[model samples]
Structures are given as structure tokens and as C-alpha cells.
Target: MAKYEALGLIETFGLVFVLEAADAMCKAADVELIGYANVASGYISVLVQGDVGACKTAVEAGVAAVKAMEGGNLYSSIVIPRPHQDLGKIIKRYSITNLVTE
Candidate 1:
């Protein structure tokens, strides 16, 4: 079983912002970059998994980094502590076409 107890999601617009958020999230805490979902119309979500505290820290860092960008616009940031087991099914349903890649 995965040791991760929390999941962090940082949603932002544009590939540039996504990259920035992901970089910040990874650098700020000991988390694993699971994957991302591109929700369409340039909206992307960067997902990370780790301990609750680490996820919180990473999300905060990711949000701060996005806000620091000149034209950065952070749509939302979420921390799901002890996400449901079925969450994986929902995530997997997101089309691969919607996977964010730059």
C-alpha cells in the first residue's frame, strides 16, 4: 500500500503555469508527481501525492509560485487528506487526451 495519506492538486491556466506549479510543488516538499489532467480550454491540474503535511506544504508553495508569476492565474488548489480508494477510478476515467504535457 502507498504510504501517501494526502493528495494535492494545483490547477492553473497555461502550460507555463503548470510547469511552474509542478516545479514548485516538487521542490517545496517530499511528494510524488502522480500526473495531471487538462480539463480543456487551457485549464490544467497538477497532482501530487504524499503525507498530509507535505501535500499541504507543496500546495502552498505551488500557489505562491503561480501568484508570483507576472500574469499567473491560479484557478484552484486542493488538498485531499485520505482520499477515497475509489478516487483512483475517477482519476483514471479522465481521458489520456486530457493529460497535460508540454
Candidate 2:
């Protein structure tokens, strides 16, 4: 199983409840949700890690669930075939010190 990572920007009518719901949905998909980081304006950013298929499914399901709960506006961007070595190289080149921290 190849590891994959996804960066999603989800917007909800209600921030708190929607964020919690999104978290639950991600957990159900067996995704390692890295939690949310409030970004520009009122959007919340979420990072997820899992198998490629699982990650894709999680992002889709999570977005759907959140939308169902309170009308969701989600943008999901996934990186496929993300091997650890490739990720490490990206981290090194980009000087991404907070690779796993945030």
C-alpha cells in the first residue's frame, strides 16, 4: 500500500460543528487526520495521510459528510504515489521543518 497525503480546504456554514464532523468522517475512513489550521478568511485547512485509495476516499467521504451535515464547501487536493523517500526529498528541498508537526 502506497502512502498518500491530501490537503483539503473545507468551508462550512458553522465552523465548530462542521470541523468536528469532518474530523469524525476522516477517522471513519481510517485517515490519519492532522487536524485543522485556520487559514486566510474563515476556511479551515486539514491534512490527511493514508493509503492512496483510502486517502482519496476519506477526502471524498469527509467532504460529503460535512456537506450533508451543514452544507459543505470543500476543496480536496491529493498527492498520489507519495513514497516516503520522495516526501523526504521534498521536505529537504523545501526546507519544510514542520513536515509532521503541522
For residues 1-102, what per-residue lDDT tens digits would candidate 2 score against the true structure?
233444333444346644655576577677665455455666655555666666667666666676565445554434344555555444333231454566
Residue 84, model 1: lDDT of 88
Alpha-carbon lDDT, every model: 0.88, 0.53
User: Candidate 2: where are CA atoms >4 Å away?
Assistant: 1-14, 17-21, 75-102
Instruction: Tell me how far the alpha carbon of residue 90 in candidate 1 is from the true structure, in angstroms, after superposition.
Output: 2.6
Residue 26 in model 1: shift from native, Å? Answer: 0.3
Give the per-residue lDDT of model 1 (tens digit) for 1-102.
146699999999999999999999999999988878888999999888899999999999999999999999999999999998878776655534456566
TM-score per candidate, chains pooled: 0.87, 0.57
Worst 10 residues of 2 by lDDT: 88-97
TM-score between model 2 and native: 0.57
